[model samples]
Target chain A: MSRTEAHPEPPALAPGEVRTRWIVSTPPILFLSLFFLAPFLIVLLASFQYPGEFGGLAPLLAQGDSPDHGLTWENYQFFFSDTLFAEIFLKSFLVAALSTLLCLVMAYPVAWLIARSPKGRRDLLVLLVILPFASNFLIRVYAWMIILGPQQALAQGVNWVLSALGQEPVNLLFSPFAVLVGMVYVHLPFMILPLATNLEKHDPLWLDAARDLGATSWQRFWRVTWPLSLPGVFAGSALVFIPVLGMFAIPDILGGTRDMLIGNLIKDQFLGVRDWPFGATLSILLTLAVLGLAGLATWAGKPRRGHD
Target chain B: MTRPSPWLLLAAGLVYAFLYLPLAIVVAYSFNDSRLNAEWVGFTLDWYRTLFNDGEMLLAARNSLLIAFTASLSATVLGTLAGMAMHRYRFRFLPFLVITPVAMPEILLGVSLLVFFLQALHLTLGMVSVILAHITFSIGFVAIVVRVRLHGLDEKIFEAARDLGATPWQTFRWVTFPLILPAMAAGMLMAFALSLDDFVITFFTAGVGVSTLPLQIYSMIKIAVTPEVNAVSTLLMLLTLVLVIAASRLDKTFMKGAA
Candidate 1:
């Protein structure tokens, strides 16, 4: 069952095996280094440089050794000097956290149901959760736009209730509520799958023991099941929270004019404002933020999962 | 297992409805006689007819197919190598290179590649750039699928092949290759599907005048709310559904890797 035993390393190395290892490993290592690793490094380098006269990054080595030859700390300083950028970062975290919370709330019951289902039906139930997600991402968001459009039944019903309550009618399509709904809808299955996998591993005998001791149903859940499921919750939250931070399409399609997140800001820099250095700066910051959060999640969940 | 309580059943049913109602409405409204998606009108095939006749849309479809084909083909070969290397060797850096793309925020990949292509390589953004970008992210998925397949295989078979005087290449050709063929097929299909359905990455890399199906759909939806968009979406959904289901059938582990 151990990894080494299952695929044992040879005690002695063969000449052909060494050659084969180098040959097999070289292509992907080279390809990823060039296309994947090199690009991020370039982004970091570009962050220190100036924006080109036309658009993209200014040439790193222009004319002479002049100070204006496309290098400065202006991008990072700009990000720090303005509180607006920090506020947007905070807003993105807030949105991502809220979406993760909503996904957990919606997914828990479904996951629990699947976990407690007959063994033969678990795969079918899990597949049912994943089926909607298999459709194109844009199509999922577009579906919500239709449902939340002004003339749609849901919007009309909400407006009628608002009128009866002496409040103004609200447009549902281009709003924060629409963005959150789209996010939760898109990410709910991620929460469900991990949670179901975890919950399915629980021993029914634990619950039976608690029940035999005259424990109430509520006590059994609160004192036993809920506490046992925290690891799954953390795993699912990380899955939902990280992606929601970088999402732009949902906000672009479903949000109001004022609903821009870090993603839209980074996007606008390159595509709209034509500031490559600033965009690269924001991207590097986001990467750092993601890595920090991922590290924190690992540190926090380390004891619960009992290993690295 | 205990039966689900009635409240649990109701909550789960609502979630299921939340998932499916939007897609059902889209398909139904695609067939509506009217242009508006707000209400269901009479049935008609006008939208499908319109989609077929739209020359620009057809061009985008062609581009998407071409990109998916080329990207998935190359990714499958590279990914199989990466997977085998990870399984058979103890390289520290290879796992990082192979897995980071699959794990990182996709927009980061998209923007970084945009910078790399435009600023470093100074290559004009076009079909070739888009295909390269697709291959970059897709190698990870295919690697994961191949790795999972290899894990389920018995190591004894390869040892037996080697003991019988088969060389490493011969062992791979006669033993490992046949065993992992289904997983490779599943990986390739998954890659093809990912490439075809990609939007955020393609959005940054496609540049001006180059369009894929998702890019084309995005522009159309932004400009208008027509049944034509819904028709195309339903068709795209059906196509992806078939591809994913087929991949799952070829390898059950595809479900795990994909999720």
Candidate 2:
């Protein structure tokens, strides 16, 4: 079916049958302008202004007539110049990347299971993937705390097994590794859902044809299935990785104090120190990074799905 | 595609285990009589009783529900209009303007909204700002959902209605509204859930004056994990699971009818 297209102009309205698609469209546009775009623009502008002790925002707009107030790159410089902030940024990127990689590896089989399973069972399996995620994310992370805490059964059991082998016991909590585990657990469903969507439409007939041509299972997968599923892989990775970068809740609850992520830094800036200007700067930069990655994902998801 | 191999089955099973292990622990620990360990100090209903009487937790719950319902209703209305616009008219930048919020990190949104509320609008950081923030981000989800439903629409039905002497409003009320109702419900459900479970954006935008369930729970966790918090978490999980399952069933029935 053809899509419902917006008329360039109402052709000619009958006296009783008035048409105002433009008017119909106004509410959302105005809402977006008021709530989303305008505020976002303010953040962009605010990030460039000079920062003060508590918050750089006051000097910029709250006291506009003050001669000392002007645009400066100092807020950005503050974040970049500090090695601690730099390390945090790097760790955020690294941890997000690693989590995405782990999710991809773990998600493939689950996606395949849901995609290739009996049609009647597909929705149930999909719901299973989404259920844990639907629950409060904080609760899920809390669950991990219980499992990974030093005195927990799993941690102690692992430690006991190691000691039995005459090795040192592992400290699982408050570590970067714990953060990674939390991230992977949280985002695995995201990776699987998109891949399952892409894979569900993949015809089993291709495998039969490849086998008829004497292609092995691995060869058929590598040659046909692998290439066809790339869009889903890219899409899912973007969904998983970007959020993982922004979500510091897992890291905060699970990660140690030494290595902070960007999310943690932003929280510290805004909530802890109450520095609005510098926080806005960091947030803007993080927003840009997320946008870049989202663009890449869209670019990758486009070539295959564009026609559909 | 014929059948998954043994390794694939095993790996998928492991993923399910990994996903549920934490949640299962939360439920199991809610009843733990012991303070912080898995010693199984014997199961007790004391935590549930504590949660019952916690005035702050109850207040936070009420606030979360109010914001969720209000935000979801408004987001659905606004998003349905936006979705209709995209379907009927060709706006050049609607997708970017509408969807960027979804792609934007929650922290940035919180920070931007904070600046906008405090500096530009001169509004206090409180419940009003939190609702607006939730609505702002949530419209994207509703828009996307409604858009998908719009795409699945059979344009011929609308054309047929117009041909049969139905006016635009009459045709929409008689035909289009009925068709998209389920999708709208799905969108509303998702918006409600997103608002309820929201943390990162809510955290940043919510000044000290406002405490949603998440913020309240966060402060509680920061202090220490208590059995009461575990009870709250369990109840929250139960609520979420029910809503999500209901939503999935709705979508399934909707799709079946649409097909």
Candidate 3:
């Protein structure tokens, strides 16, 4: 037997355990507290601050002519009163939901195939799925510009085929459809990876058991495979959905400037209009929404200790 | 296992094609001698030559490498520490705090940072801001990877080392570090790739005068598409391919060792 196997088990409360744990955690805790937590706190505080007349933050405690004087809901009030903010928020959610749905549809089949493929070929297929992500994201989205453009080879070929069939050429680019395509294309791998990981854990015996119990293939899948894979499905969906909500470049590039999402609005607030406080408020709200969704997913996915 | 279905294979093949065809077209057009992004005339290496010769593209590439290297390295270090903490210790709010970045949208993070930097901090948009922002997101990924690795580890080894009079730091360096090195490497590589590919966050935080390859590509696309950009992209893709292969190989080796 190896030395490791020969050794007796150690007690849980070993000496130096507390110190070691503290040492292990301190660096990351320090880094995150300073960089991630602090900056976010700053933004959260900025969000609550009132906006100056010139669109800057006034001092919170001091009453002044500046916009950032004590606590006020003026920025959020502005967001609520404006129809554009609501429209943009709803549109962003729709885009994210549709994108997540599309990714689920697209990724499931690909992941299933990958999981079932011969071991020799599986790695290569997985590699292909991951390869596109390595390229510049904006450039890959730009590639669609060529594919979906009027003179794009695919479009031209389609146009030719349509003319032969007595149909008119279609303008498919620069639409919500195009944005959905881009989002799915970009995020499919995120969906696939988590799904594949979960699916790979599933034993074939479960299916065999179902079959032996006189279940049809569809029934076996719906009862066994689907339930088993819910964790991954939720995870992958959240992964794709959350990012799609914040997506700016995909819609901006593919759907064009006309289809502005909330991300674009936030960007416009900061850079275009130079409204930092309002932008901060939008960001905080969006962050809260994401946190809420994530919390829901976790609650749903949490395993019952005794049941499993 | 069931027999392989032909329909399933065909569907997978079509999806792969859909995913790759646009990219393949860009690569093919990079070699075309045509001035227009569309309508390939013939194959030529001129675009690559132009890409290499263009000072702005080269500078952008250099900046991208610099930012990715620095940000990813820092994220790896911090993430490893965080992962070790989560794995070794049970703390209240640990999971919640660790998962916050994962759940938060990149856009909100980006804009928030942009707002903080511009308004509150009064920091200029430059390499420092970009690196800080990249590290913020990349560290979470690295921590997750390392956390997985740590979960699979045997605790007895560390206990034995400590019993043998090794200090906590020594126990980690001699016992824990080597075991988790593969995950560290994977996390670092992922961090680098993410930093290199980051557009949205970088776009917001990267104030005036600082440009990485993705930022450069974004600006260039806003104006027009060029074969030179495609060539640069092809090169970036190849580089990413190499790094991913290396990281995956390391990961497989580590998995094998663990198994």
Candidate 4:
């Protein structure tokens, strides 16, 4: 439902009702303003301030002699000045795109099957999709560590195949391959659930009508089902894509020396190198990137949605 | 309705297999006698025994439980209020504030909270900070669940309570509270699970010396490889499984809220 539609019209409040409404709403408003909204503003401010001599940020206000002790656009400048940072941003975008695509491909068949299944079993199927996701996120990543460990069966089997093919044995863990696997494994449900929800709403009569017109199954799917499912694909992609873009843990745990992404770079700034300004700058840019892409997606989807 | 194609069934089956195989391996290997997660040597309870005895792991678990309990309890109360507020009155910022945290990439929340605690609040990164971060994120989830519950309900019942001699507080305490109890329960469980499983935000906000199960698990996964990690993972999965089942029983749509 549209948010405006959800709200309807606000009624005039009685005096006591006004107080009751305030009482009901104030606690959360105050709490979120203090913690949620304030922190974001703080991070925005932190991004401009200079790094302290020791660690964290320098003073917000200028000291007696040193204007350099206060704010500067140095953090943002450093981001734009360095090709390394740009490359990491590009790499993260590529990883997010690839993960979304992979999730889409893997999720489509499962979503289609679930939608076409007996109505009695759809909830159970959805639950099955969500079951793995409900487990700890780190545990899910660690599962891959076990699976792709050098001495594990999957790796050993692959290396054996490589050796027989006259190639050197390849390490599976601590590789881009491992990171992609982790990303897809963790995010697949995000794609599946939305896709299934959309697919479940499709009118079977449309497909049947096409079939009766002597359309091939491939034609029916390509022309009808695929076109109708794009909205679902877009929703699922946004859910998978945004988080994957900022994901540090998957890459941190699964990637090798060469496979650093934006999340890792930002994390390194704060936890690793103790540079708060740079970290805050990266975070702000990432937030901007997410918002920009989301705005673009909504704009792109508008015409298609209007067509439907 | 016609049946799904055998080919489609096979494809979906493979996807399901892909999803479960890794987790199944972890569970299977937790009991393996080998020190490494490589191959099965023999069955032993030694890893679980090791997990029980490890002081750090035990403390982390205790901290996690405490944080989850405190955070979820507070979140449920605040979230119920937020939900009711949103349902009753139209607001520009309330829904935005509540929902954005749920929608935003979690790392952003973690990083911002880290910045806030260190710089703005001048607070130490420890259990209190971690709990606050947990509550901040979890409130949105609890609110969503409670809102969904409120949406299905008929307003006439509350109106009827007011038609009688019931005051606003009496109506809320006697009528509204009982009606939304299941949702409140479901929301609390959802929050508990979220706070317990949280890693990214807790990692940023937990500072030094305050370890949750996830932080402990992350270090163990990164620095050391032992069947003990597997044991802990298995137990965590089991705990989540129970919570999910309990939450779903309380409210079936909790699964949807969770997703």
Candidate 5:
């Protein structure tokens, strides 16, 4: 009757047994440490170094103006003083949050429908949802350029329709709205997949039970479905929000020179301004902020395993 | 369960149309005889011929393939090892370290790698640098997938193998590897697609002369949007579609196995 009865027993490790697990793991650990970890440490170190007049690493240590070696908060000071940094950071958060909210609003209904669909149509629906993600991201984003361009068929068509309606042509491209559209389009699947998976795993008996107990539809959703699906919502939001926050390509390609996000600022510091220290500082701060937000989300969405 | 809602169906259809319409237009325009992306002059295979005949595009395609193949292979191996270690061991900081790359944005990773190469390492950007950067991000993805598959694996199989006089390596090769192979394959394919499509990291890490497909497309789009680019995009999209279908098939098979 039990699932365990279907399989044969297997032996356990002897008492006090210790295997050489580190040998298999050390290579990857060392690789990540040297390449991934060390680079970030170097960036962190460089953040303290002064920026030269030519926007290179300054010889703060050589000047002997500061204690120990080259060190200065001038780059951070500059970034703080420049209101543009705060504006860009705030804009980045706003875009990511709005995109996340949009994805949740749109994806939940779709995911719920897919989860409740008949067996025959479920696979087809799932495939439809996932197929777009398989395509090259850059190509897909660029496809938006063709769709949103002034001379684009869709744009022109919309313009003609507006003209027929005695209204002005809509300018949807190269604006914050365009950026949001692209971001949500690109990230919608990330929100849907986790939500659908979790919803599919959820039992309908609980909802039926609630309905049978004289609960309204809203009460059933609030009492049974919503609490159970919180984990999925948390996961989907994190998946969508984090990448949207760090998105550089969507805003760059769609918003053009008019818009700037934290990603663009970081990129500009490194390439255009050649201020590696400042860029590294910005990147580290952004990474920490993301990590903090993710932690907060997970804590807030923690499932009460034993309560139910 | 409730019957199908017409409103829900309508919303789903509209969303699908919105998602696929742009891609459909690109594919349709690829066959247009016009050089510009705006007007579809007439249907012809001229753009595809142009895509094939262009030496630079061909070279870029080859480079993209080379980079994706090499990076995905190395990432799969390294990621499998890392995933297994995390699943089986109690090493402190293992979880944090493995998922760090996922949190960091690709642009930052690309820029940091560029800085590290130019400033600290004194290495010029080239194929090797691109591959290194690709591996850096791809490893996290592969690790996550493999770890998920490993989580569903029964520990008893490995214990049985070990008890039957099999070495650790043998146990892993015969039992663990086979069990997680589907996830590993899916991960590798996804990594390949990601590496091939990568623009930002490759853009930064590629040396002055080297050009990948995405890099070529980026530069070309900057100057002008051409039908040949559309042709190339169509091909890339088809290729990715095939890979995704294959991955999903493998996913189904793995799920069946688990069931």
Candidate 6:
């Protein structure tokens, strides 16, 4: 009844001819168990415990006197207890949503452009999308730091113009806008990849047919192109949204110390507050959220474009 | 069909601009002579020399390269087997489960793995722990890549090999193995790149002074950005750009050979 029933053969693989199905898959099965499943299980168990000192956990069944004491919902309660915590949860979701939206807007056109290009150009564009991701993410974020720093050229230009107009130069770094800019910068490629893959598979003949039938370009897009591209949009959104939801580095570097997201909250619990149990609880909550989103995406993936 | 709307092309150009400009700035600023990043002084390579001379930075780079090499090798092996199994057999939801490590927020993976090692296994956190952690997350990337490559392979070839009285071992060695080798290598390279660039998971698993290049860069930036950080970052970007181009070339050659 376990989910990982190792390689139950379908009717296709004749059972007698094979040595055994499970034998071949055992290495990967064991690898996933020892590394992934076991660690996740530990986190789950730890999440049920009381917060002990310095990244330690009290026994899950231990006794408690106060709300913050042993083996209580206290840790979980405390995390979601305040309005600020709730605000952070909502804010993280909103930021991810907006970021995904912005990525969609920027990426769809680019993905479409790449898909429609000739082989040489298309490969070049896709390479452009991928080459950046191969570099360090922190380095890229740090790039944004200097670019938007008050003393940087762009900011200095703004200040020069502002001084002429007798207005003060604006602080750009460590703001919500800067966070959005960084999120869009980092996540754009993720959005582009899926959408481009889907678009590349689309037959240009569909567009030709619609045009020959006297449909306007806009009508053709709305009637056929948009519907056909929903799967890509869905896939891209899922990819972009999930990561942006748990984004720590961007918010930390760009959003400043004032605006806290769920990742920062979780990081604080472990490193700053030293509440291992509460941090574990938050991790579990995020895992569930991730799974839920993935499930929703899978369910919605009807592949109605008729291309599977 | 309608020439892709000039607007789309413009947008694509802008997207590329957005992606590369920050990186270009880093590369440009690495040559900046002034310690202050605000204004450019005369061009100089002093920062590059500084980064080269920093013993700790080089050690971290060496550590990262070693760990990435080993982790990617193990990941390639695990991924190849998993891809073959998924291709040969049917397991509903297996693909979904396999991708969870990659799809789940990396922070969760880092935190959970850290807790597992420290609290549950009581394993010492160092290069070994970091390598194990890298292999764990990277397996999914390799598996997905190898699986996609395997999907394009013709199953009839396997049947033909079998019909010729080749044993399963021979079929795999001569037929399957040769065909998927490029993909496996690409997967490994990608895993290598991912391991090299990882920060969040490495941050958690690499305990007690075991710093990778990204961790080294992170620490450096956490205090303040210096010319050395810029120089080192530009070098990382250059390395990655080279790796990606090399991997893509391999992929293209594989496609040509397949065709």
How would you encode candidate 1's per-residue C-alpha lDDT over A1-308 as one tens digit per residue?
13535777678768888999898999998999999999999999989998887888777787556445667999999999999999999999999999999999999999999999986788889888888898889999999999999999899999999999999999999999999999999999989998888789888888899999999999988888877877788778888998899999999999998899999999999899989899999999999988888877776654354321
lDDT digits (tens) for residues B154-178 of candidate 6? 6678778877987767887899889
Comparison by TM-score, 2 against 6, better one: 2
Q: What is the Å distance of residue B36 in model 5 from its true position?
A: 2.9
Better of 1 and 5 by TM-score: 1
Q: Is the docking of candidate 6 incorrect, acceptable, medium or high quality?
A: medium
Poorest 10 consecutive residues by lDDT, candidate 6 chain A: A1-10
DockQ of each: 0.73, 0.59, 0.54, 0.73, 0.48, 0.53
In candidate 3, chain A reaches a TM of 0.85
DockQ (0 to 1) for model 3:
0.54
* Model 2 regions more than 4 Å off: A1-19, A52-56, A61-67, A164-168, A304-308, B253-259
Checking candidate 3 for backbone clashes, the offending pairs are A51-A67, A52-A67, A57-A68, A58-A68
lDDT of 1 by residue, B135-214 (tens): 99999999989988899888889888888999889989999999999999999999999999999999999899589999
The TM-score measured for candidate 5 stands at 0.90
| Candidate 1 residue B202 C-alpha distance from true site, Å | 0.2
Residue B105 shift from truth in candidate 6, angstroms: 1.2
- For all candidates in order, the CA lDDT equals 0.90, 0.82, 0.80, 0.90, 0.80, 0.82
True contacts kept of each: 0.73, 0.71, 0.67, 0.75, 0.48, 0.68
Kindly report which residue stretches of model 5 are placed more than 4 angstroms away from their true locations once superposed.
A1-19, A52-56, A63-69, A157-170, A213-224, A304-308, B207-209, B253-259
Instruction: For model 2, give the TM-score of chain B.
Output: 0.94
Q: On a 0 to 100 scale, what is the lDDT of residue A267 in model 6? A: 80
